[model samples]
Target: MKSAILQEADAEQFAEAGFAVLPGLYAPAELAALLRTVEQAPVSGPNFRRSQEVFAIRDMVGAVPALWPLLDTAALRQLLGQLFPTGCQLVKAIYFDKPAGSNWLVAWHQDLMINVSQRTDQPGFGPWTSKPEGVSVQPPVAVLENVVTLRLHLDDCDATNGALKVVPGSHRRGVVPAAAIAELTPEATVCAVPAGGVMLMKPLLLHASNRSTGNRPRRVMHLEFASVELPAGLAWREGKRLMM
Candidate 1:
């Protein structure tokens, strides 16, 4: 089995490319349990969205409380510990799934906004917006650089099944202007991951996905972790912290 610990090479890859994919992070039964929990989660939350093309929960672990216990598994903790030796707070979690024949497509963009509990007078933090999830604001560039995202795949992902496409080292340029993102790259690497694998990436990574051309579902749990605390009175919306 592939080790959950981030190796030296993996760390370098993340430092240079801003993303890395680790396959076979979960066992078959573990993946099954996650899918079952999500399937049974009540669809009665403001963050829940269901349509012909996609199923998503913005405040995922909050909406499905049962998911908290499931996520406390030892394997995940090991991986988190390697990244954040002291500890890391789970700032956000999202459940997203693209069903077979679903025409769901996402454009290349950086995850610059963060969902916070309330608006506070914090210098360098601005461009606030309200959404069903919570109050999302674009924090300082330093904050965005420290945000790490782990995408847990519940199904196989590939070029034909809407796998993510990311521009290598695009994050090194810092927050690229919206108009400059399109010019960031015409070259990207397809990050294919098997079921139960995890894709680790920085929040500033330029990533996108194409509509599925294959007949397979792509279900993923997107979890964000922050190693630093917010300034001012601002708090993470979820405030769900996990450690080994």
Candidate 2:
């Protein structure tokens, strides 16, 4: 399905609110196809997280090559171009499924870290860590400032279904201290999205989610894009640069 075009109002809203919802970005058929693909793919692995109520496919793009064509379609390329006019590349992608009975809850915080190919002693890049998916590092705020994350909702997401709660304009507070996160008093917004809608948010935005209390599952495909190239010797973990 064709992705929705990024409007000027969306750009303005993202700059001011740190996020913007692109309603009905994907057609119903597109969502159905994606769900089918997920069901058929051989994704069970160490990167895949499974529980009685929750299941997640981490590093989905890396795990399922067949999904690349759908993800890199022309419509999506155009949408990403609007956000990254200078040109951008895919950094990471993951699929999250929170079932009705899953007791999954994420606390309020910022996505301050990023995925890198390897760990190195780089100035301003610290708090390094490792994950089953890839190496993680806390890069400078400038790097994250240029990063945009698009979350495609496979199910209707609302407050009852684990929709993201974000502190609007928090992206402007570069590198907010963990202790100071609560100190920054700003009105939060619930990012409710439709089944085929998309939520565009900055990597530095302060956001979190609650456990689903609804009866249906809340599935989301999270894709992150960044235009900035890492310093020499440092590379993106996925490294699937878009040829835009």
Backbone clashes under 3 angstroms, per model: 0, 0
Q: Candidate 2 on 1-244: residue-level lDDT in tens? A: 5444888898899999899999877888888888888888875677687777777887788887777776666667788878877788888889899988677899988888888989877889989998776699999999999899999999999999899999999999898888998866457879999998889999889999988887878999999989898998799987688867
lDDT of each: 0.89, 0.86
The CA lDDT at 89 in model 2 is 85
Our model 1 lands, by Cα RMSD against the true structure, at 1.7
Q: Candidate 1 lDDT, tens digit per residue, 1-244?
A: 6555677898899999999888877888889999999999877769899999999988888888888788777878888888888998899999999998888799999888999999886899999998766798999999998888999999999988899999999988888888988777686889999998999999989999999999999999999998889986999888777755
Q: Provide TM-scores for the models.
A: 0.96, 0.94
**Model 1, stretches more than 4 Å misplaced?**
1-4
Candidate 1 local Cα displacement, residue 46, angstroms: 0.6
Minimal lDDT window, size 10, model 2: 66-75
